[model samples]
Target: MRKLLSILMILLSIQAFAQDDKSKDRIDYSGEYNGTFTDIKDAEGTMQLFLYQPDKGRTSGIILLTRIVNGKSEVTTGTINIEGNGEFISGNFMPSEIKYIAPREDEDGIMQNTYDSYSCRWEIFGQITDKKGNTIIGKAVPANCVESNLIEFRINKKK
Candidate 1:
């Protein structure tokens, strides 16, 4: 009877540990994010972000361009998937390509127009948070880069 009781206690401990582990892998992101695109050549814009955390370890949102060249505004939707346990987050933008006119000087000394596509990718590294102001003990380094361009942004989450 004592041996059986000991085995039962061990099982209970194992179950509790498993639950804790699962909880630690959860992430919560619910807030408005304002991002500035630095290191961009010949581009001026401020990106307004709205993020919704439908569940742990997952986030989705839309990014709007409040300012850009030619007085044009654009919006794009994207998803963020985070692995809390690994402290890594990666996501891709839908319609992943944006076209814009490249600024150039022509023989006439006037700005000539050339179309170019910019590809975007978001990568984040930091600690995941929960609703009750509790953080899942981890780290995240979030970065966004445009392909084929020298533009890249690396932002650390503000405490």
Candidate 2:
């Protein structure tokens, strides 16, 4: 009887641990979010965001800009620092840098260093209120470039 009871307890413990592991994936801020930036002149069109939880109070996601200011598809990777669990979340999109070879005329008026490189980059910011349930509504702000503007967005947990 003692051996049987011990075996049962061990099985139950294993089951409980497994359940706990699954909860890690059900984070409050993990989901697919869809919304638009409020400022239409600077940035028009819609944006989609996919956010996932790496650990508690942290989130990682991708931001997709469609038909915005530049009339081109833009994708950005971002991280958010969540405080008060799901009360507040804010982060900036890591700037995407492009390096390309450019040919420029030297002082002697001769094209030289055709392999010379140049880079351009832009960044965006997100500040939102976490509903603590399944929705996060926030604003997307552009920075580090020409214009600084605000865009509103709301993201919900994916079913």
Candidate 3:
């Protein structure tokens, strides 16, 4: 019985050490990341983010989400906030504007209509993934719950 108890105690200590090590393996989420997303079948969208350290334990940045709708590209800007204690790899994408760009003409005789482009208010939560921490995956839900389909995105950092 004593020998079994000793083995169990050793295993518990190892498990605690592993938890500490895993917490220490936090990724530094800085620099720029770009990737694509899909909300539905064949729906293509792009995402770009630039993260920087504003202060100690505070990371902020600007992200752009460009989605194609009816053959025209629409842009939505969001403010990124990674406000946590030591874990700065997970955060959110808060919509800055429903539509960063209004539908207009391109100087020539072409009408680029992106009406209601600013109507996308998705609550997106992103988390860093991969062993090397070079990738980020996120899921979003429309603010008004209009989009029942899953809105998933994945971004990667450049080497």
lDDT (C-alpha, whole model) for all candidates: 0.48, 0.55, 0.69
Clashing pairs in 1: 124-142, 125-140, 125-141, 126-139, 126-140, 126-141
User: How do the candidates rank by lDDT, highest first?
Assistant: 3, 2, 1
Stretch of 10 with least lDDT, candidate 1: 133-142
Which is superior by lDDT, 2 or 3? 3
> In candidate 2, what are the lDDT values of residues 27-113, reduced to their tens digit?
466677776644535545566668776655466666655543356654433343333344555566643444345767989998754
Question: Against the hidden reference, what TM-scores do the models get?
Answer: 0.50, 0.50, 0.59
Candidate 2 lDDT score at position 61: 69
Q: Pick by TM-score: which candidate is best?
A: 3
TM-score of 2: 0.50
Candidate with more favorable, higher TM-score: 1 or 3: 3
Q: How does residue 129 of candidate 3 score in lDDT?
A: 64
| Index of the highest-lDDT prediction | 3
Clashing pairs in 3: 98-118, 99-118
Q: What is the lDDT of candidate 1?
A: 0.48
Across 117-141, the per-residue lDDT of candidate 1 in tens digits comes to 2335544343334444233332222
Model 3 CA deviation exceeding 4 Å by range: 1-25, 54-56, 83-90, 99-121, 144-149
